[model samples]
Target: MPAVSAVSAAPLPAPPRTLGTGLLLVVLVVAFEAMAVGTVLPRVASELQGLSLYGWASSAFLLSSLFGAVLGGVLSDRRGLAWGAGFSLAVFAAGLLVGGLAPTMLVFVLGRLIQGLGAGGLGALPFAVVTAHYPEAQRARMLAAVASAWLLPALVGPLVASLIADTWSWRAVFWGLVPLLALIAPLCLWPLRGPAPRVGEGSGGAGLLRPALGLALAAGALVEGLRSPGPLGAGLVGLGGAGVVLTARHLFPAGLLRFAGGLPTALAVRGLAAFALLGANSFLPLALHELRGLSLTAAGWVLSLGGATWTLGSWAQAQAERRWGPGSRPLRVRVGLGLMATGLLASALAVLGGLPLWAVYPSWVLACFGMGVGYNSNSLYALAAAPPGESGRLSGQLANIEVLMVAVAAGVGGALIARLPLERAFALAFAVTLLAAVLGWLAAGRLRRTS
Candidate 1:
């Protein structure tokens, strides 16, 4: 019950150090794959031309990834991060190959589902490895470095994918990643060790189910928005909603659902922050290419800036955390969200004011910077708060919950865009981002006081 960490701040997690370079390489390939696809997605959809299913394309990856993360955590807790990560890598690669060759939109989605499944484990496991292997004090820097790895993909992935899609085929984007994964998988071997324990007894019956439910709910909302082909989506939503209620109770702490604790509030804010960022990300490129008539390369340039800005923001956050005390963490996070709200609002204004398409990018860059700062703050906060041995459970649940919100927001937000003019759609996105900022401030405030 005592506050300050019982764990020492020395001897950084053995796993990341032992596997530092290798694990980072793994993170880069994964980040690159995700970033690259974002660049080419607009072109892919343009050719496939299923405007209604656009969100589903991304959500398929998110929803399956939700389940995959839960499964990974449990497996990591049982089989260890090494095996968990390795299995995920295999699945992830299969998904890319499958997606690259998809003839139809539905099949393409199937590939995304596979990718998501793999992603679930891929996304959270590294953080867990870092936590379990290193000292608590080492976490902030290691996590930042982990984040910094994204810098390259952000800077390069878009432009690379854009050029490939324009010159050759979007399929090249996936094909190119195959080798990256092939190399990254083996590097995990040095880090793979024995199983670590969960944060708690893992909540009883529905421990890991919360994320799936969240995914289902998100997909359901998308279905609600689209009224997609059959009732399957609705059914999925109902199941997800019910599961969210029951499983969340077990997955999170006592007051998470109610936002009573700083941890719960912080985690919730993280989800909203993700919603604001990802919903816009899902829409922006499409807006540029589909509506504004920008080529993939042109649109990618905008995305590259956003990625670069994200890194700058993260760098700023890490610097602030290091220079200031622990309280600085939430403060930086709040600042990040405020910036996002401002950026999104600015973009909305530009669109409404009939500003040139190129003019709106500065705001988009700010939004991405906000994401980098806000996400890292929330993640570090969550990981730091978790009891030792529970890093995997806590981080896994956090990742799952956040992604579920993102998937739902994308589907719902994407559809809203389909219904509105460019300005109106962006206006809605701006409003959502603002709300997310307010929530982030409140959530972060809890930590500000607690620390």
Candidate 2:
């Protein structure tokens, strides 16, 4: 009886750390693909004589992502992280293949839509995986590592994509990623192999699919409406705006728009931050080149600096958590939002006020720093608060809000630029983004409330 007791009490094996690191690396690959695709998209449009449909390529991706995000969460909750993750990668690889071999612009856009689907799902799965697999103590560090992965892509993605487009062909860029993904797929899948752990109760995956598609359409219409010209555009915008409100109700947790406390507020804050930051980021290079008269190379370098500084900020949050603790989450969020507002406002002044070009540099660093801390921390808090079996849902909501905000920002920015003078347009965009940061700051308080 004593011997049997000792055998039963023996230590269980330690969970593999490779899973955490591999997931981060998978995010790295996704970031790189997104960054690289953006770099060469212009050439692809020109070569395929699809300048008219240029915006559609990206819009399609954004639209499809809505479905992907929700589906990923549902799948993860029902089947497990492995199934969701594997499917996303497979779909992503297929998109890359189709896009790479596409001979027409329409086909290319179709490929992008597929890619968006996969990328969206892939994006959500990482958070779900982290929540399901990682210990609370290591989650922040893992998130920090994920954030850091973006640094390399942001620094080199554009240059590499451009060089390949110039020296060889854009197809190579897409095809090139295939082999790399083949390698990454195995690393990611290696840890996922084994008996699947049920993340929730019985599978009800199909139930979420319909609403997800509706949400995707809503976002797509909004993007298209904003980009279109004249009364038609206005009509689409009106219709799409209505659809967004209606569809979002089903897509998000109840009371999200009303700022209901708990997961809803956290998700809302994330949406606001993304809206502010991505809106500003989309315009930063344009402002630098057009207003400041900097060369493209110079503008790229400035962006790179911001990306590098973002990594620093991510590392700082991890270090703070390691040294101090999680009790400071609210303070971190507040400070992050404050910095974001300050940086964007200062940048708006620099751009609109005609300050020296160099002024924009420090402003971007500050803004990126804020994003690094705020975004990662927001994810950590929201996921941490999520009820068991609902991590995937939280992840989906967070990603959905972010994707929607970014699309809205881009659409709004484009509309402004079309209507007003470049400088005024950019100034207004920056001002709007600053307001988003302020909103985020206000919303952060709700996170402390019990969900």
Candidate 3:
């Protein structure tokens, strides 16, 4: 509502030529791998006889990515965005190889950890690219373009993986991604080849290296602690929580834990949405199959459909921003979070009450759509809030928080599903996520106050 200043306003930039296309390509490969993995993870679990560790398969990626994101951010700040982005892609490709050939669940998890590291890095650096290259005015549309990249993959990834899983082997899904990564990595890194952002003399981007590792440990401990029962579990949980709080304080913006106003609140909503939506998403396939009696293919379709709608919401937001201007962000974020909360609540109700199966599909679409809109808005808000020269670090911090909470949510939710009855476990999981969504909705209120 206040007058926008030149420093903060998203001035129009030269029209993006190849930069946007290359970045979208990068996103597509990563997204395909992710969506494909989800499609076959159940099969992977069954084949490996590691059904109990199903959540870890996904959590391991998220856990390691937390450190990867921080490392990437620092490296980008200290060196260049291209350097960070390239490194993450190489690491990600190797992870696919490792995962494709994994002989057991332990090995598979290791591969996931490696892949996550790259994903975290790749995830953060793109924002840096946008920050450095695009004007704030073009950011929304640019971000929407990035979101749209996921459309094709979302529409086909699951089906492709399912077909591969059914006809050939799950390993093919992993192996197949390797070559594509090889092709796209260079293109993705090309636009980033120029002067990098300047880091302050004493900012010591390198200094945070140790803290990144510490954050990863804390993440793992939190997941492990939640999974474990009894005194030992409680102790691990406590230790992990403490580590998270301590390490996060350094890695994230100040006052994140206290839900500090402005950028802090925006970051909170991002993490909370990940915690709420992805936590449930991680297990939704399992729930669909176990509780609702849907087949694996059917479950995969639900995920694909949800992804498409998420993209739709993202595009819709982009259009609104283009037409209505930046003033629309707060309203868009509020609407997105509200939809997310509503969707989560609706799903929980359907699951808990044993309603008709058809109801779940629409509920999920709403939730994903909410995420598409809110998550994208949060990125713009966070980037906008960054002080001059802090965009990369802030983006990394946001990514780190999002991945960390998702890891925790999935880890804890998976553990619950393993131990409890299907109905009760899902109910509790949805409830926890519902709580997270509500928290995010509350957090959205502060977005306009930032910067």
Candidate 4:
């Protein structure tokens, strides 16, 4: 009887369908807004006669979202994912409504600030949900799916927004998303209902808020400073830079600036990757339009194509992980960063050298692809390394840092463009991105230690 016994391996649990659907919906909505907003902002400014506060519309959302990210992380850890998500979504919806109904630019900026609070939390909450709900084996696919959600929006959001604004009104862009949010809210929340299981002790409290506020203020000052001219701009820059340095310690993991090994380094690399890719991307359209004599439409197409390729790269990493195991992450990061650097260099040549206009397409594609691969890899590493109960905090930090770096990169690049000639400004901007990518590549080895 004993000799007749048989052993069978248990099958892995299937992925969470509702959770996946809800997350994808969230990503889709957010991505669409991100893609479409720029198209309609000009209209918003003109209609409101808020050209002077134009930059603040974007800056207010960004800075407020930084605070939201921290607050959401704390809520997720303490209150549970469902509570945090619901609260964030409600805030976001309210902001949309306010923006849609806004009569003045001041009112609209207020709405944007409100939206940023919710949006930041929304951005951070997904990582906590995935970490808490999805099985370890399935995380890669889920992340890849999230990346894929951006593809549709990336492809059509701008064009659709433009059409909507042309046919209806720019406010329609804000109003349209409300119904979609209503539909998605239940799907996401129903599954997440009830208290989140405590994986570890809750960490951040109201104590962290001061530093978060400081960080947000610092970012705002820096951007405004970059936009300003002369002594006042320099003073603002110095103050903002000082504030960031002083406050960052409270928000980021220890040794982040020094690139301490493991999780800290991984987080640093993520920030650097964003700095390199997004900074370059922020200016790519301008470069193509001004330098290469491409029409705005043609330049937009290049961005859309780059976005699609980035999704492809994300999927590629997921598949690679499935075949080769999680151990492949460090190599993926390194290769991705290296490719990004190469692409930036190519873009510089295409714009500055005698290369044909067509050259920019391939170069931008390469850089975006690298971003897709490396960015996801860094995320996986950070999430994996997060201590129990700390996923939300870490994820929020991740979002916060990326946002901060991007703001800095864009601000610096914009400042250069404002002061220098077009060619020289672009050259310096590309140089900054290139330098970031190279530093990221050099630091990527630390990710292996965490692995």
Worst 10 contiguous positions by lDDT, candidate 1 = 1-10
Cα-lDDT of candidate 4: 0.85
Rank by TM-score, highest first. 4, 2, 3, 1
* Best lDDT among the predictions, by candidate number: 4
Q: How accurate is candidate 1 locally (lDDT)?
A: 0.71
**Against the hidden true structure, what lDDT does model 3 obtain?**
0.82
| Model 4 alpha-carbon drift over 4 Å, by segment | 1-15, 199-202, 449-451
Q: Write the per-residue lDDT of candidate 3 for residues 298-404, one digit (tens) a residue.
A: 88788788888888888888887788777667778888989989987887666566667888889999999988888887777777766656666776887888888
Q: RMSD per prediction, one decimal?
A: 3.8, 5.3, 2.7, 5.2
Report the alpha-carbon TM-score of model 1 versus the true structure: 0.84
Candidate 1: list runs displaced more than 4 Å: 1-18, 39-55, 101-105, 162-172, 195-200, 203-247, 286-299, 354-359, 448-451
TM, every model? 0.84, 0.94, 0.91, 0.95
Q: Model 2, stretches more than 4 Å misplaced?
A: 1-14, 194-204, 449-451
Segments of candidate 3 deviating more than 4 angstroms? 1-16, 42-55, 103-105, 165-169, 201-204, 449-451
> Comparing 2 and 3 by TM-score, which wins?
2
Error of 1 at 221 (Å): 5.4
- Supply the TM-score for candidate 3: 0.91
